[model samples]
Target: MVHKFAIEQGALIEQLPEFIQSHFNMVIDVKADGPCGYHVVAHSLGRGEELEFYSKEYTFSNIHQTLGSIYPTPSEPVGTKHWMSMPSMVEAIANAFESPVFFFSPNLFSIMLPSLLSAQSNSRNIYCISTKYTPFCVLNDEPYEFPAPRYLKNWEKSATKEALGWAQLYSPNFQKAHD
Candidate 1:
């Protein structure tokens, strides 16, 4: 369902950057009900299972085993603070696919600061994206709220460069260790 706020409020989308606007055309509608995050990740990894089945099979069934297997060392633990219980799920997905998980969030540096900071520093292939207009959630059934950065709205300034700088600094280090 499209977020109600996005449809009712034209100003939000109208003020977004051109690049973000262009990307909007390709939006894929995922089922909002149930574990949408898991569904999206599973879909991305080519896992055709539904949310419930995937959660039960991959997450609940063997989360501790998965975590122990990946992060056997005590120095580097596996889990997320803000996203409690999600670290295990993430670890399971990453281990299952043998690929890194990249989480893109507009508020990664802000709202997700605790989780980001407390995340396993040595978790390989887990890239984080902090940028403007990051889709957060569906507000009442209009479209996903793609709120422009506050700096953009107030000063007509784009934080893309700063965001990219942060990503560049962190991503390379994360990838280097893994590679």
Candidate 2:
């Protein structure tokens, strides 16, 4: 799919723009490694421009303190684990490309509030991507069966304290994290 997006097929070569077609041909004929994702940076529409992007997977896990604190439920329901969806990934990429923005996953705040506080800058816009149901443990009247003991509303205070130290560190911000 990406190849088609970048280059034309063998028989459809004539349909493509000459410059792009020629570039693709030369790249395939000369370049040793197969199709690698790289920015086609050109300063004067020719060569020597600044363009870079990483196509590697960045894995995230809870920090030690967080793990120890949430000992009772090492793993919560849907939202507890480190899972990045397609839209969140796209938003991160867009933010990275557009401005001096700090993209953080929802769980990171509860886990690394102090570190984030320390690294905070005036110009940086911190964007946290989260879903309502995932991070939020709602005991509404909806028809659903939770696997484990869902933390009742009463346990929220202590649990937040134990798992995140959420209120103590971030306070008002912690409220957002909890939500």
Candidate 3:
């Protein structure tokens, strides 16, 4: 669920950090649904249907091969944990599309960064942005937005005493180490 909208210049004057709120007049809010990550990658690469089918097949094959003996048969509701393997999914997407993958998450940066970095290679370019979510003024019932340029630029500025502080500390060294 990717949503695109425009924000009034000073709509969020008192809410978001000045740096994050000022970077863009337009914004995209990607809802953090179960398949949100996959959808983002597929849509970005312009391989929507193909990626979806590949994901389904890949997940089913991996699950059967890796955990078939343990589970024996499928559970009642079906366990989706194996299906949502981010590292494997991202790797598959990158390889299939033959393009760099950029993952930006408001949280889960620390947990995801190491694996993504280790998986990086001369042929594969994987970038991760772990930052705090900024609330770009509410309009009707739509979800919040994260201004990309502002969020990326925030990496270079002073760390805010909020959720983003830890991200700032980790980002520079993490990027340097990985790159």
Candidate 4:
């Protein structure tokens, strides 16, 4: 029902590429405040027709409990409520696609901003997003605080050129892009 509505509204369709025709994967990640874990949906692209959408939902708390109970010695590391379960969820959905497809997650991207920005140590993605004017210091599920200035300085030194390129797109000069 929701998927149909999304299609009607063009929210999900707008994100899809031309090769994709009809199908798409919808993944839903359950929020920590909710009963379910996050979900990820992937769609498969067909040769001439639209893509086929496959949807999957997974619960982190349930998996964590299962893993903990089965393997008492080696439990998965903890993660933010929403982002922690994302990788596996997305992987499973991708396998179902059977063909390459565009992945769409509007809210998910924003929620994972902190981790995405900080994915690589001393990398540029984080540095680019953590600039003086438009810094990202908040995790969606956690509190937001400004890290020490020294920490930022060290980050700038280690960030990669590629990260810098992306950062420039979001800088003040790219006001049109920002809009």
lDDT of each: 0.34, 0.24, 0.36, 0.24
Model 3 stretches astray by more than 4 angstroms: 3-27, 47-88, 104-131, 134-179
Query: Which tens-of-lDDT digit does each residue in 1-179 have in candidate 2?
Result: 11222332343333333322332222111111111111111111122222211222222243344323422332442232333332234323322332111122223311222211222222222222222212111011111111111222432343323333322333433343234
Q: Give a tens-digit lDDT track for model 3, residues 1-179.
A: 45443533254332334534343343334344333444444444334423345446444556434433322232242345633344445435544444334343443322222212222222322332223443111111111222222133433243223434333434443454344
The 10 consecutive residues of candidate 4 with the worst lDDT sum are 134-143
Q: Which clashing pairs does model 1 show?
A: 2-141, 2-142, 2-143, 3-142, 3-143, 4-141, 4-142
The candidate that wins on TM-score is: 3
Poorest stretch of ten by lDDT in candidate 2: 137-146
Residue 161 local lDDT, model 2: 33
Candidate 1 residues lying further than 4 Å off, grouped into runs, are: 1-26, 49-89, 109-179
lDDT of 4 by residue, 20-114 (tens): 21332332211122111211121112111111221113334455554333321233423344332332343232223221111223222211111
For residues 1-179, what per-residue lDDT tens digits would candidate 1 score against the true structure?
22233332333333334433432322322333333344445444444324344546554556555333433244443333322233235434444543344443432221111122223333333222222432322112112123222111321132223232333334443343334
TM-score of each: 0.31, 0.17, 0.32, 0.22
How much does candidate 3 score in TM-score?
0.32
